[model samples]
Target: MSKPVVLTIAGSDSGGGAGIQADLKTFNSTGSFGTSVITCLTAQNPDGVTGILEVDAGFLEKQMRAVFSYFPVKAVKTGMLFSESLIRTVSRILKEYRAKGQDFHLVVDPVMVATSGAKLLQDEAISSLIQELLPMAGIVTPNLDEAKILGSGEIQTSQEMKPEAISLSKKLGVPVLLKGGHLKHSAEALDILSFPNGESLSYSKPFVQDFNPHGTGCTYSSAIASYLGQGESISSAVGKARDFLHSAIVQSFPAGKSKTLNHNPD
Candidate 1:
């Protein structure tokens, strides 16, 4: 029995908490063969990012093509595409696959910010991502702050998240998962999902102290993509992803003066 193939096109995290590292772990945990195309290299850790080196656009495209050329990729997840050019390059590759009649189950984590309060996506890149990359995605996952930026308003309460998520999903022509992780006062973390079909779903988990949740977003989104790679429905995938992420938080341990999640917890 061959494992299903899935790909993660994102930055490399030297810290191994997020980016390509987290994606690969989630993919394999869901029983898929994980492949990757690195977009940038970030010197990151539990504390913060120190430096970043982006891959050349041409080389980035080449790496993507190399994977698509060989693997029967059932799902592709994108994260931390730092520049407009990089986003464009990734979008073009997806378009090529689409043109070839190869449907891609794209999971786009609109990763604009890092847990350490560092900006991961460029201001210029947001427009290109909105116009080119997001439409191709089967789903887009954004935290409250990111949703506010993408949706153009404040989503301060659970009530606010629904309309914004529905609005964004309608605008993007795909489902949207709006994470309420930033709602600091909530006893439990909540997330809302709005599908293009006008249907909505909600999930909640005991809120993990967000202080040093190094890869929470990455892990959650990667889990969704991984489950999708195994042919799970979007809602089911989201549920499992939430549950897995909650467990990761439970198993989290201290590292480097801060705490980091157990991406592949036993």
Candidate 2:
């Protein structure tokens, strides 16, 4: 039961599908201890999100301080920080830790939209994430739509992914995982990993037909964070994480009416 402690600073999903739920489940599957600091709470099901309640920024930092006081987190990830204020607060805490020489990595999932097409991150949150969060992120995982918002506009095909991945990585000075799950009519789901050092890699898995899953982005980024937390290199972490996520998605099943990834025992 001895595993490296990893932290997820994200929103609570009442649906138990994405955000903190998906992240903690991935940590457990990938052999890491998971701790969480909830930034907000969402009333959502597999079908959609109905409501949201954000935590106070001061209390959010309090949760972070409490976690840091006990466990030396090796890697951390952020999901669904719905406000610029929330984004700034989290970055400030991480900056403080880095100043004191606490070694850790950050995985930022720019969660802009839900599986059901609802806007999760407010419009004002984008600049905050770019200015305050992305610079500190060890890697940022953005789906096709998010990639468009981040820099490359309207990336509708697999061809546009690599350049955007590289460009965004160079622009942010951090590794970027540009996920190609939403590209229509693609035979295989392609994901491009662009490193800040001008290197890149691509991983592809056969698209799971009929499995339009929820929590996939959350689960994938969490797996990478978990592997990195366990001292795996970025390349190894993402490669292994990609494999793990493929299997999880392949094993997906229905939760009531909506499809969801079966990350348990992954």
Candidate 3:
């Protein structure tokens, strides 16, 4: 049987633990063929990012067109679009593809901040992402901090997550998957998936201790895209992705003073 093709449009992690690397690994692990359009290149490791070189907007459009022109891309995920121009470029291309009657699930991983506390998305680009890119997504995955920025105000606990997710989903006209991994006080890592219809799904896993989840957000969103590409409903995709990510976290291994998710965990 042929595997569904899923595309990841994101930066390249020189460390190989996040961004395009993690996304591609998760896509294959979840039974999909992975393709990529690198938006930028990051010089970094599991420790921290030193520099970033963004791809030009025109070249980004070229890459998108090249991929969609041939492959039957079933799903596409975006991460770390560092600038306003790139965000608008991506949104326009996606809208054009949809206008041409092409069908594909778009998963938006609103990666604003890196695990190492490096700013991945520019502050000036936040508005462009919220306005131009987010509405085109089938689901937008945001961590606690990103959620707080996109939504109304501060999110202190998991209790505050649900309503904010619901509100964000309604506001964006897309499903919102609010990741609570940042809520360290909780015994369980809780994630909420809120639909515009006022429905919500919760996924909880025993939180791993002393572990740095370097590529988790990228992996989770890509896994969802892979599942969605395989024809699963959005809710089912989130559930499956959660389970996959939880397993990867539990089966993590040591790498350069930190741990990396075992993307191909057996």
Candidate 4:
């Protein structure tokens, strides 16, 4: 049997700890063939993002088209689309691909903020993402801060997360994987997966006491998409992905002077 092919459309992390690098590592670790289309390149380390250079929208579209034309992409995951034009281009590609009857799984990790407190997406791009890409997503993953931004400051607590997830799913007409990583709790990391079919799943893991777990959200969502490409159901894929991320965080290593890189399994 052939391994599944997974593609990540995101930013490049110069530190090799997050964004496109992390997504590819997670995908390969999960036994999938990983590919990438970089939206932006960041000169960043664990401490902070020093600079970012975004690729032109035309070039981004060309890259996406080239990948789709050549590879049998089983699943596609998106992260750190930094501009409104990039978001729209991605949405257009997805819409066109769907029109061709391609059932490519899409995992959207709405990466609006970085672990070092840097804003990864433009403020105007947030509206574009919600309006354009959300409806086409198979699963939209947003951490607490991203959720609050998406919800317009409505979600604060874990209890509030469920309703917001449901609302977002309904409004966008897609499933949502609302991550609980930013919540100031020690017990468990709870992530809510709400589907349009009126079904919901809550995945929770014992919180690892790692303060420098960078790229966790990217890893989890990309892993889920990889598992989905490997023929797992959504719930099963999410469960396995969560397990993988927990283990990775449990065995994390300090990468830079400040943050750590969660280990992808050997």
Taking all chains together, each candidate's TM-score versus the true structure is 0.96, 0.97, 0.98, 0.94
Q: Worst lDDT window (10 residues) for model 3?
A: 148-157
Model 3, C-alpha of 62: deviation from truth (Å): 1.1
RMSD of 1: 1.4
Q: Residues 136-202, candidate 3, lDDT per residue (tens digit)? A: 8999999989987887457888798888889888888889999999986888899999999989999
Superposed model 2: Cα runs more than 4 Å off? none
Instruction: State residue 107's C-alpha deviation in candidate 2, in Å.
Output: 0.6
TM-score pick, better of 3 and 4: 3
Q: Between prediction 1 and prediction 3, which has the larger TM-score? A: 3
Q: Whole-model lDDT for model 2 versus the true structure?
A: 0.90
lDDT for each residue of candidate 4 in 159-211, tens digit (9 for 90 to 100): 87777777767766888888887778547788889887667889888877845
lDDT-based ranking: 3, 2, 1, 4
lDDT of 2 by residue, 77-181 (tens): 999999988999999999998888889989999999997998889998899999988999999999988988888667878888898899889888999999998
The weakest ten consecutive residues by lDDT in model 1 span 206-215
Weakest lDDT window of 10 consecutive positions for candidate 4: 257-266
Candidate 4 TM-score, true structure as reference: 0.94
Which is the winner by lDDT between candidate 3 and candidate 4?
3
**Best candidate (score: TM-score):** 3
- lDDT score for candidate 1 against the true structure: 0.86
The number of clashing residue pairs in each candidate reads 0, 0, 0, 0
